[model samples]
Target: MADTQRTSERINFVHQDEIWKAHVKVEKDSAEVWPRKWGFLTEAYKEFERDSVKLKEVKVTPSHHLATRPLTPPEKYTNVGPSPPVPQTTQALIGWRSAHSRLQLEQHGQVHHGRRSFLKVLGWPRDACS
Candidate 1:
């Protein structure tokens, strides 16, 4: 349908643009901006696609094993030792999810959870989100 068409179009656009980059014919000023503004999306889309396939083989349900567990505050956690820092890409993904959820709540009166919100932002075909 329309969603599939849009996804294909985006893939085609990225492929063609990459070809242009390889040819060294890119407009440098704009080229520098393009990847910074949207590079995570392309990478995220690929990841989402890979995760979707793997998810299909497992039971889909929320786990509450630790929902009632006592939590360590950040101050306590940090005092223990230096933990590995979150990568820039992970930070960006967190920001996107938070912002998207907020926007949906404000505009649509409902929030789309992780997978649907992610696919919606990427304009990918959303088979299901629940």
Candidate 2:
């Protein structure tokens, strides 16, 4: 009985192995004629190559402002007589403050709406316009 059971299990294993091998063969044959598979792969590779070349061309060049050489002060510095004091109008001051506030809010990921922090403070209600 033990030998008979072993022989049956071996046969089942062989059958499963044969089925797997046949499946692999079928996949290999089908893949050979897959529409534009190779062409698509080659085109994808070419696109990657093109992008790589473009990226290389766009690599950041060092700017003069960031150069390692020591910066020398300007040769001539003239101080013109005290300039006349400029008057600040309320509206201009308010506009400047608003602009500054907006910049600060933007830095903190908050939207600015010209004196309306109601919508911004409440996590910017979903329906709010961008």
Candidate 3:
């Protein structure tokens, strides 16, 4: 039928027009714009490098005291053995106790005892007290 043919032709024409408009828009937005932007960034970085060199020349001096102090060797009597492996449950308990002790110290200016003593004071399970 001619009516169906005319409707199909109209639909095809609209679709082709949309595709042409998209192509035109893409062409108008330069394909080289991204490369040009990167070139500008590189030029800016070179300028920054030049400025930094000039600043260092003006401000840097000998005897700037940048060398680190030599580390003192440990005492001969100090124990240097590998630390004992802590169980996961013990580690978690210790971490909790340490955090709690720090908070108590901050609030009261002192904790009653070290980690083990603090755990005992908190009445944590006997196993965790160790």
lDDT of each: 0.68, 0.69, 0.67
**Residue-level lDDT tens digits of model 1 in 70-128:** 78788965544333445478656564534544333365465667654777887877785
Inter-residue clash pairs, candidate 1: none
Lowest lDDT 10-mer window, candidate 3?
Answer: 96-105
Give me the displacement of residue 33 in model 3, in angstroms: 12
Models, CA RMSD each: 32.6, 14.1, 15.2
Q: Rank the candidates by lDDT, best first.
A: 2, 1, 3
For candidate 3, lDDT tens digit of each residue in 1-130?
A: 6646775454577787899999988877766576675678878899999999898889655574886777767775554444444547865756553454433336556556745666568877668834
In terms of TM-score, the best-performing candidate is 2
Candidate rank order under TM-score: 2, 3, 1
Per-residue CA lDDT of model 2 for 4-95, tens digit only, reads: 67754545777778999999999998887775556588778999999999998996989999889866555546333443334387666554
Clashing residue pairs for model 2: none
- Candidate 1 vs candidate 3: the TM-score winner is 3
